[model samples]
Target: MAWTTIIPATALHDLIGQGAPVLVLDCEFDLGDPARGRSVYRAGHIPGARYVHLDDDMSARPDGSNGRHPLPDPAALAARLRALGLHRGQQVVAYDGNGGFYAARLWWMLRWLGHEAVAVLDGGRQAWLAEGFVLESDDPAPVAEGDFTIAPALVGGVVSADEVLANIARGDLLVVDARDPARFAGAPHPLDTVSGHIPGARNRFLRDNFDATGKFKLPAELAREFAMVLGETPPDKAVMQCGSGVTACANALAMEIAGLKGAKLYPGSWSEWTSDPARPVATGQA
Candidate 1:
């Protein structure tokens, strides 16, 4: 079976040593300095791990309306993956410096493209380093290009700002924001010009999904925690969002790991929602 949601550091080490057909991607990124991720990768990274830039590879240029990190074009993403040596049935593991926030974005992107053999490294590079794994400064030689193709349809696991607005008006879908409490409460708008969350959206900070050591909490604990937020709403009817649709994937991944599937992502998120002057914004908690 494919490793779909999350993988541990030891398991990944074994996979690499055993020469398993796995593609390791270093997704370390600094939101303030976009170029810092590649530089960090150049200094040292996991053996045979290719670096994926959040802005260049994982997202498209913002058109001033599609939020800060718009989803990349499917065909372009497929080409990039093929160039990176991703192939059918190859397990892909992505990791970041900051927990699994950015890494989970790549995991969600692969699943959005209909590839199931992808996962985020739990606790990310921090976990690997803590486990005394070796790091390599040299970049891997390019491998033979693979024949990875984009799926015909986007299928599921995504929602647009329009859909969110419609849902809000209908009062049926439950929208969850994964940003910090202060940001969700409309104070200290650091990233975007907006200072609040979407009206009717509940705050569920992503960091709460992890433990003190930054590792994800046990599955049962996660399930119970999310159960509080979900209440009577079914998982399939819930939507997750964050500042720029980045960290929100962390919540989606956690939900899947907790066996609560079918929650969709709002890729346009608050960035896109606030770009318009007409959308309602809420503050001071849910």
Candidate 2:
């Protein structure tokens, strides 16, 4: 079976060294400094890992309405992946300096493009370093392009801002916000002009999914925690959101890893939600 949600650093190392055809991508990124990710990757990264920039590869230019990091064009992203030698039957592992924050974006993007054999490196580059794994500063030779095709029909992984509003109005869907408690409570507007969360959304900070060491919590623990938050709501009836839909994928990834699937992403998230003056914004916990 393909590693679909998350992979450990040891497993990733073994895969790249001896397992089936694998494509490792370094997705290190800093939201404050976009160029720093590439600079860091160039400095040192996992062997045979190609760098994927969040702005250039994973997301499109912000249009002031589509949130900060809108999903890239499917065909364009597929072409880029193909150029990176991504093809059928290849397991793609994405990692970053942060604990799968940016890495999960690429993981979700691959699934959105119809490739299910992709995963985020659990604990990411931090865990790799902690494991005493060797890093490679030299760039590898160019890889031959692979025949990766775009499957637009598989684009059922997202929900629109309007859909989110409708869900809130209907009071049927469980909208989960991945932002920190402070940001969700409408205080300290660091990134956005407006602070607060969707009126009916519940807060489930992404950091809560990880342990003190920064690794994700056990699958059973995650499932139980989500179960408490979800109550009677099914996984399919839930939607995940964050600042600009980037870190939201982290929550979605955690859900999938915990065997709770079918959660849709509100790609517009708080950034796009607050873009309109008419939208209602709620402060404090849910």
Candidate 3:
């Protein structure tokens, strides 16, 4: 079976043992210290796992108008993925220490490029370590170039700033912000110039998707919780966003795990929303 949403450490371990064609990626990152991700990867990582950088690999160079961590150009990203040993049908597992926050970005990007075999490792690097798996500090051997090709996306599509702006007037879409409550509540943001969220957006912090163990809540539980948040709106009509569009993927992943699919991602999100002074920004709770 193809693991698309979240995969447990034990299952990943067994998957490796079975000698399937898999590509494991270590996506650990720190927003504050950007260099720390590669540093940590060199210190230790899942054996045979290659490291992917948030800024260098996953995002494009952002201008003033585009949000921080703008989505990488599709063609450029496809080439990088090919070099990273990502074949079309290979099982790709991504993991990060901070819940699935960083890894989910890669997971979402892969899906955006029409790769359905990608999944975020449940509970991330900590889970692997907790399960008695030893991490290797040695650099992985060079891999043969892969033949992964980009195709029409198999999952949800990207929502544009224009669509989100028009939605404010249409009121047909449910825009959910996945940043922390404080950031959603108009607290002075450290990253972006504007603090508040979109005019009609509701706050659904990505952390809420996880339990005490940092693993995602059960599918039924997530479904119920999202039902309350979504009200009468269906998943297909919802739009997920965050500060720079990273954490938003975690929410989308949660919705998918809850069997509520088709929520589109706003890759530019609030960072792009606030770039233009004319766009409306609403403070306080929705």
Best by TM-score: 3
Compared with the true structure, what per-residue lDDT tens digits does model 1 show for residues 97-160?
A: 8889999999989988888889899899989999999899997988999988876332247888
Q: Which structure is stronger by TM-score: 2 or 3? A: 3
**Candidate 1 at residue 168, lDDT?**
76
Better of 1 and 2 by lDDT: 1
What is the C-alpha lDDT profile of model 2 across 170-279, one tens digit per residue?
98788899999999988877798798889888888999999988888999999999898788989988888999999988888888879898888888889889888888
Candidate 3 lDDT trough over 10 residues, lowest sum: 151-160
Show model 1 residue runs off by greater than 4 Å: 152-155
* Per-prediction TM-score to the true structure, in the order listed: 0.97, 0.96, 0.98
Per residue, candidate 3 scores C-alpha lDDT tens digits across 1-286 of: 8999999999999888887888999999999999999999999998889999999999999997889999999999999999998898889999999898999999999998999999999999889999998899999889889999998885678889999999999999999999988998989977979889999889898999999999999999999999988999999898999989899999999999999989999999999999999999999998
Ranking by TM-score: 3, 1, 2
Model 3 vs. true fold: TM: 0.98
Q: Which is the leading candidate under lDDT?
A: 3
Clashing pairs in 1: none
